[model samples]
Target chain A: MIYKSLLPIIITLLITMAMLNYLISHVGNEEVKALEVENEYLLTINVFKQLNNTVPKIFQAKACLLISNPINYTCNVIASNITGIIMNALGIISNESSGVVRYEVVDYVIYGINNETIYYVTIKALTPMGDTTGIVGYTYPFNLCYYSQFIKELMNTLNANFTIDVENITVVQSSLGNEIINRVKSLIGTSSINITINIYYVGVFRMINRSINRTTYLGQVSYTARISPNNVHTCNEITTLAGAFYVTAVVNRYVNNTYYFSINGAININSMVINDKTR
Target chain B: MVVVDSLVFPDLVITMILIIIILLLIVYVTNQLIELSMIDYKASMGTYLFLKCQLGNFTIHLNHVIITNGTSSSNYLLICPQLVVNGSQIGAKVYTAYVKW
Candidate 1:
C-alpha cells in the first residue's frame, strides 16, 4: 500500500518538473532576444571604426585625406557593402545601401594623450534596423614626441635660432622629408610608399619681399604620411611633428601608420610676437 | 517479512526498478524540451576597478551579478605600469576591462 502511494507522488513530481521547465523556457526566450537586440544596436554604432581601419587598398589615399573634415569620409563607408572584399566585418547583413553603404558623420574628434591618437567617429547608420547611431574610436599608438628623431631633425632643420625661411619652406620641407624617408627606408619605392607634409599657414596675410606675390602667414604644418602596411614604420618614425613649432595641432595619421606625438613650446606666433621670440 | 510473501517481494523489486527508469526518462525529456526553446540572456560591461578588483562579483546589483572585474596584468613584472593610476582613473592609462555577463 505504501509503494502504491509513493508511485502517485513520483508521477506528480515528474509532471511538476516538466511544467516548470516549459514555463521558464517559454517566458525567457523573448527576454534573451531583447538583450541580443541591444548588443546589436551598440555594435552597429561602433562598426564604423572597423570600416575606417580596413580601408580597401585602392581607396587609401582618398579615404585618409589629410584630416580636413575626415568625418565626411570616416562615416560614409559601411563594411556590409563590400561583400567579398570586406564581407560585413561587423556581420551586418540587413544593412544594405544600393551597393554603397553610407552614414551621416555626426562628429569627429582626435584625442592625443598617453601615447595614442584616438580617431573618434560618431555616425548615424541607416539600415533595415532603421536610423541606428554609433561611434567608432580608432586608435593608433602615437602622440609621444619627446623621444622622436623626427622632431629632433625638424628642429635641426629650423636651426638654433628657430627662423623658418618662409620663401623656401615648401622646397625645404620637401627635401627634408625626402632625406628622412631615405634614412628610414633602405629601399624607397614611389609606388609602395607615399608621404605628404602639409603646412597650414594660420597668420595675417601681408605682402613681404620677393617671397610672395600674395600675402603670407606661417601656419601649422601637419606632417602626415600615408603608408601601406608594407611600409608602415618607415613613415611612422617622424610622425610626431609638434616639437619645435608655434600654433600646432598636428594630425600625424597615415591610417594604421601610427605617428608618435610630441608637443613642446605650444606658443602661437601672432605677427608681433613672432620676430622677437624666434631669435 | 513473512507477512508479504516471496511472490509479493518480486513485485516490490519490479516497482522500484520501474520508478527509477521513469524518473531518469522524465529528467532527460525535460532537459531536451528546455534546451530547444530557451535562449540565455547576455550582457557586457566595461570599467576600471583597481587592485582590489573582484572577478565573478556583481558589477551592478540588479538582482544578478557580472563582467570585466579584474586588474593586474599577468607576470606583474612592470611595477610602474602596474601603479600608473591611483583611486581616480583620470588619465585613462588604466585600461577599462570589458566582459560578457
Candidate 2:
C-alpha cells in the first residue's frame, strides 16, 4: 500500500520537473531574441541622431552667404529660398526612409554673377550602428550637382537673366593634402589667379574612463585670393577684391571611430572688381 | 532500505537537471543583453564635419566640407585673403604648412 502511494507522488514530481525545464528553456530563447532586436533598433536610432547633428553645421555655415546681397535678391530672400530647398529635400528623404536615412552635402558648386566658371564644394556625413562600447560606422558621400545647374536654379527662382551649362562633377580622394593642391593646380594651370587653401582639423572627444577621449573628426577650408586682370602689363594695377568668402565646419563620426575637422576662410580676388571696370 | 534508496536517487537526479537548465538560460540572456547595449551606444554617436569660411567683413557659408588624402606629394596649405575689408576680398598671401601622418 505504501509503495503504491509513493509511486504516484514520484511520477507526479517527474512530470512537474520536465514541464518547468521546457518552459524555462523557451523563455530563455525568447529573451535572447528580444535582446538582439533591441540592440539593432538602438543602433539605428543612434546613427540617425549623429547624422542629424552633423548636417546642420553645413547649413549654418552656408547661411552666412545670405548676408551678402546679390544683384537682384537680398540676403534674407536668398536665405529663405535655400532654406526651403533644404527643408524640402530633408522632408522627402525622411519620408522615403521612414526616418532611417540621413545625409549632408559633401561637395557643391556655385557660379558667379555672369555664370562663367563654377565653384565646387564638398560635404560628408556619417552613419553609426551598435552600442557605445563597440560600434560600426559608415560614411556616406553627398555631391551637389555642377555649378551650372546650381546657377540655373538660382537664376530661375530670382528671374535673373543668367544661363549656364554644367560641364562635369567629380570627387577624387587624396591620400595626402598635396593631392588637393595638385588637383587645383591642374584646374587653374597657368592661370594668373593665385589660389590659396587653408585647411584646419579639429578633434572631437568623448568622456571615457574618467577622461575625455578623442571620438570623431571635423574640418574647415578657406581661401585667400589676389588677382590682377592683366598680369603682364598691370604691375601697378593690383587691387583688393570684394566679396571674399570663408568656410568653417565641424566633423564627427560614430561609425568608424574616426573624426576630422577644419575651419576655412576663403577670399577670391577675381570676385572683386573695381566698380569702374567691366571685364 | 532498498526501496528508500531507489526513491532518493531519482529525486536527486531530477533536481540536478533542473538547476543546470536554469543556469544555461541565465547565461544566454546575459550575453545577449551585453551585445545589444554596446551596439546601441555606438549608433548614438555618428561622424560629421562642420565647415565655415570667413572673408573680409563678409563670410560665405559652406555647410559641409570633406577631405581626402590623395597623393604622396608634398604641398603647402594656404589661406589667402587673410583679411576682408569693406565689401572687397584681400589676400594676406600667407600659407600654413602641414605634413601627412
Candidate 3:
C-alpha cells in the first residue's frame, strides 16, 4: 500500500527533472546564438569604419599626383614630391624607384554648372636605374580615366584635395625574365586609380629537397624599403613623382647536382602616373 | 513463515533492479551535461583570447611568452616591431633573441 501511494510522486519528480534539463539546454543554445550574432555584427561594423577612413586619404594623394606637372622631374625629385603629398594627405609611403618611365592620365565627361568638360591629361616620366645599366620599361594605359572620376567623387565627399587616375600604364622588361615582367604588369593591371605599392629587392637562393630524387630546392627572396619612403610628404611628392621606380631582382637556376643561384640584382625601373585632369 | 520469506526476497530484488537502472540513467545524463559545459567553457576562452590578441603590444608579449615559450625554452625568437599606420603594419623588423631554459 505504501509503494502504490509513492509511485505517482516518484513519476512526477522524474518528469520535472527531465523538463528542467530541457529548459536549461534550450536557454544555453539561445545564448550561444546571440553571442555569435553579436560577434559577426561587430566585425562587420569595424571593417566598414576602416574603409570609410582610408578611401578619402588615398583619393587626395592621388589627385595631387594627377594635377602635378612632370616635365624636368627627375626620379628623385618625383619621389620626394610624392612623399610630401602623401604626408600631407595622411598616407603612408611604401616604396619608390627613380629609374623607370611612368605615365598616367584620365579622360572623363564632367557635368558641372550646366557644362560638360571632356578633358584628358597625361603625365609621362622616365628615370635611370643604377649607373645606366638597369632595365627600363614604360606603362601607358588609357582606361584609367574612369577610375579617376570615382576618386574625385570620393575626395569631394571627404572634403579632400588629392586624386589619382590611371590613363595608360605599360611595363616592359629588357634584362629581367618574362615571368617577372609579367608579374609586375599584372599587379599594375589590378589597380583602379590610386597607386599604392611595395617594391621588394629580391634575390634567388636555392636549397636541396629530398623528395624529388636527386636534389630539389626552394628559392629565397628578401625585400627592404627603409630608405624609400618614411614620411608622407616625401613619399607622395618625390617617390611617386619619379614616375618610374627601379628595384633589384635575382634568378636561380639548377642543373644536375650543382646548385646555381644567379645574382641578378640589376636595376630595373618602371613608371606609372596620371597624365591629365579636368577640374 | 514461508510467506514472509518469499515476500522479503521479491522486495529486495525489485529494489536492487530499480537502483541499478536509476544509477545508469544518472551517469549518462551527468556525463553529457559535463561534456557540453566543457565545450562552452572552451568556446568562451577562445573568444576572450582572440580579443586579447588584438591589443597589439599585449598580444605580442603574450604570444612571446606562451605561444613561443621563450621564457623557459632554448629557441630563437624573432620579433617584428612595426607601427600600425592606416591599419597596416609598416617598418617591421625580424630580430632574433635566444632564450635559455
Please compute DockQ, using alpha carbons, for every candidate against the native two-chain complex.
0.04, 0.01, 0.03
Stretches of candidate 3 above 4 Å error? A1-16, A53-64, A67-279, B1-8, B46-50, B53-101
Candidate 1 residue lDDT tens string, A79-166? 2112222222322222321212234656655444544434454566654336777665445443322113233443344322222333
- TM-score, predicted candidate 2 vs. hidden true structure: 0.23
Cα deviation of A24, candidate 2, in Å: 1.8
- Each model's lDDT: 0.35, 0.31, 0.33
Candidate 2, after superposition: displacement of residue A142 in Å?
17
Q: Using alpha carbons, what is the TM-score of model 3? A: 0.31
* Model 1, residue A38: C-alpha shift (Å): 5.9
Interface RMSD of predicted model 3: 11.3
- Give interface RMSD (Å), model 2: 16.3
True contacts kept of each: 0.04, 0.00, 0.00
lDDT of 3 by residue, A1-279 (tens): 334444555566567568657855875676455444433322222222332344334333443354332223222333334333323222211111111212221111211121111221122221121111111111122222333343333223222211111121111123333443344344334333333333333444353443333334333434322111112242244222111122222222223443535333333323243112211
Q: Please provide, for model 2 over A52-127, each residue's C-alpha lDDT reduced to its tens digit, 9 standing for 90 to 100.
A: 4433443333323321222233323433443344334434433333333234544343433331222332323222
